[model samples]
Target: MKNITYYLKATFSWFVLPFIVLVLASAAPVKNDVSEKEVIRLGFIPLTDCAPIIMAKELGLFEKYGVNVEVTKEASWANVRDKILTGELDGAHCLFSMPFSVYTGIGGKAGSEMKVAMILNNNGQAITLSKDFCGKVGFKQTGKVASVVAAKLKADKEVTFAMTFPGGTHDVWLRYWLAAANVSQKTAKIITIPPPQMVANMKVGNMDGYCVGEPWNGVAVKQGIGFTEISTQDIWKHHPEKALVVNKKFSETRREDLKNVMKAVLEACKWLDNRANRKRAAEIIGKLPYVNAPADVIEARLMGDYNLGCDQGIEIYRDNYMLFHRNGETNLPRKSHAIWFMAQYMRFDYLKEAPDYNAIADKLILQDLYKEVATSMKIKIPEDDMKPFVIDLDKAKFDPNAPADYLKQVNSINQ
Candidate 1:
């Protein structure tokens, strides 16, 4: 009886132990299918709008999302473009129109397809004139500014203006302001100066005025070297500005990694949009490796407290200030914005002929990818990606469907 009992116990133990092992093995969690990249190298220029990328690195948002990110401070937009194209950098805080220009073959040597993953920020840039023009031209008074330019031209004195990049937001703002005043940008010398250098160049009388992103604009005002003629917001409220961009190959090959990076940046953007966080955000990005500007300089404009430095006194425009993630409005990679940029390029003769606007925008903007990232974050995605918006200049409505007709009606100095 004892032997029979022992045999039965042994048999039960063998069957039960095997079944337990099999159940545990089957229940173990599956390894994540998403490929985790070891390191992501991102490039950025020393401008206030680079806050999203800088804050992401400083706040460990990238690591929080399982991405190891390294932020490189690039010297200029040209350098940023080159690094992205050559894979020296994985991605960059680039001008909104930059990827479009690159993809369309207008920005560099040859056309290399590029992608604008997301918009970094909007409406922080300003058009600043040297102190010499302080009493001569006033804010948003483009007609007076044009008259001054005309007078300078009549006297055989050269009037030079600067923008950060040829087809960049700064260039568009400066050109739009000039054109609105009947001052042909072609008639006035338009030069490209790095944003950080705009103040120094103005002090040395290299340029009469410049349009650039902060804190350089704020720095100029603080240094008493230049004054803000107008904020970019005045030209077009909440205009699309800097973007988070990458090469097409990178976007396609490392899609998961790109999505992770975008998720990190979106979090940073949300953090920055909170007015309570602006002071801290300014402090972080103002560090030596990032913007390298004074915290006060970066914080003021960042919080919508503008001195204008034109003796116009301080003005608080909280609602119309630079925005990062206004409930996802600022970050959406809208195709309409891209269409407007292409329209500008064509209007300025950057493109000899208008390529398929929707096609180019669809190829470059990656709205669907943005939607995927935003949705995963529980951020509300706008139902209509393309909406008709009006610029403050002429109140001319821009219909994404008929960009060509809008271009025809657009008051282009290039024409």
Candidate 2:
């Protein structure tokens, strides 16, 4: 009788424990429904604009949003683009125009659709000329530089300039600056060099000048190899620069994951825009695994303390500095900004004909998604999508409504 009772109790215990375990499992909340932990990988190059993504990971903002993120340091913009295209990386700190170019099949393998979830930064890049061109061409004097290049071409030599990527902000800025001086980009050779390699390439006489983002430009000046001829802000004040881009497939299938990621990055950008945190931010991003430069080298530009380094004295530009979040202005993924970039694509003959500007802008720029994230964060959204504005140097107003006419007015447009 005792043996029979013990057997009965053991059998009853198994059934009761299984039922309780099932109930508890059903009651537990789901943490990340969109993606599994340790699955998402974000790529970034070693530049200042990559700060938000880095900060997001370092500050545990990604974790706060219940998303696991691994930030991968990329070597070049092309690598970043290719990784996104091949699905090796989930997203990256990319050029503002890169996704558009990929969408249009400008420089990628084919027309692989991509999306710009948000603009990463603006007004931090500059045109750095080699020390060799110091005395010959002054800042913003593209005409003199053109004349020098023309003479070089006349002597059966090549005048080469480098940008970070083709159809990128650096390329567009360099081309626009040259065109303003009546120099045809066709007359000179333009090469693509990665940002981190710009200073070293210039040092070896590989290129006459390069247009790239901060720390590299700052690195050039500090190494006495190059000088800043003009900043991108000087080209067009508060012009768009880098963006957070992702594969279109990822965006479509994993919308919630993307939203959470954007929220974390937006929070990071807000933290960076605070002037008081910049010094600490600089130190954090300048470590060997990140920008891999000295904190002071990165901080000077981050704080708007410019040392043009071509016998041009220092200039302080606190208002038009590299801004990540200016009361939510910097975070807006404006369609007008997309239209402007498309206009440049048309200008440079990247597109044989004018694209459906509005359609393309609407498709590639995730403005509505950006708004949702911004609103949830209590950040103000822009009242309108198309804001009419003029670039400071050009003085010609850009109307997103009439991109074709604006392209015609541009002296740089290739006929």
Candidate 3:
């Protein structure tokens, strides 16, 4: 009797298991018509702008949109780009210029193609120097750039500066600052270090200065290793930084899923940008596996309370810091921004020759997708949002339509 009962139970369990799974699956909400079983794998650097991904996961936005999302922390921008190219990453919190570089076959890809879905953050990066140097330069409030560079140049010692990637915003900011001080990068040595390593490297004398994104800059100052020399936003207010990037293949094959992910991220950005929630967001981000730094260190910057760590002291409210949802600024993959990066690439000789500017901008930047996601969520989309915001870094007006010519003009200013 016992043997017969066991056999009957085994047979019944097999029949019921599929039915239960089918019923559970039927109850799941489907967005974008993609099945619940589909999973999205994304990559991000340990920077603050990646808050959207973490916030989206925390708020159940990914689940709401039928995306079983797996967020991975990539070591560097190069790793992020490689993973996207090989389809190892469905998407990434990548540098804004990365897709443009890939599309132009500039840095990593010889012929590989990629695209950016949206701009993630604007202006949460800083150029910081070792504290010893800060004291040596007799840091000044008015003559900030000249005083530091002049003191260092008089010493006739080589100053080693580090940046996050070859053509990234950190690098551009560093170079621009150096040029402003009449310090030729051709004479100075610049190295690529990961963002998280900037502070530690400075402490060990591996680098004299670095240009990196948030938390790390704060980390350096907090640890008493370095002082914030210049915030990148001060150089070019509301500068473009990271983005939602993926291979052109994934963007095409998983178009619906991709759109859904963007929608969820836009919602996350809205939540993160809320003024009342800034403190809570800082606390959340400072925990393990995220920034893992002090809450106060992360808090002040996110809320726009900045300290230079020099005797120059603090900036109470700087409006130029990262604004994920201010007037939906983060969503627009603006053409002018791409043109700026293209010019940077040309200025740095990252490109062997000039690229087809208009075609590359259109192919890489998908403002249409951003608009669709924003409109669906009832977020106000700006009509002239994509208009040009030129930087006088090289003392020239950048033309979005003729980016190559703009590049040449900017380059000529320096020469």
Segments of candidate 1 deviating more than 4 angstroms: 1-37, 140-156
On TM-score, who's better, 1 or 3? 1
* All candidates in order of lDDT, best leading: 1, 2, 3
**Clashes in candidate 3: how many?**
0
lDDT agreement of model 2 with the native: 0.84
lDDT of 2 by residue, 221-299 (tens): 9999988888888879878898999988888888998999999999999999999999999999999999988799899
Which residue pairs show collisions in model 2?
none
User: What TM-score against the true fold does each predicted structure earn?
Assistant: 0.88, 0.88, 0.86
Ranking by TM-score: 1, 2, 3
What TM-score does candidate 2 reach? Answer: 0.88
Q: Report, for all candidates in order, the number of backbone clashes.
A: 0, 0, 0
Candidate 3 residue lDDT tens string, 1-415: 9999998888778887778889999999755433456678999888888888878877888877777788888888889888999999999898888777766666576557768898778888888888876655522356456435523643566778899877777887888787677665676678999887888888899878888989998888788888888777777767778889887888888888898899888888888788788788888877887777788988889988887786668866557777887778667888777777887777766776777767678878888888888888888886654455556343456667667666555533223
Model 1: weakest 10-residue lDDT segment is: 142-151
Q: Model 2, which residues run further than 4 Å from truth? A: 1-38, 140-156, 413-415
Which regions in candidate 3 have their CA more than 4 angstroms from the true location?
Answer: 1-36, 135-140, 147-156, 392-396, 408-415
Q: What does candidate 1 score on TM?
A: 0.88
lDDT of model 2 at residue 268?
93
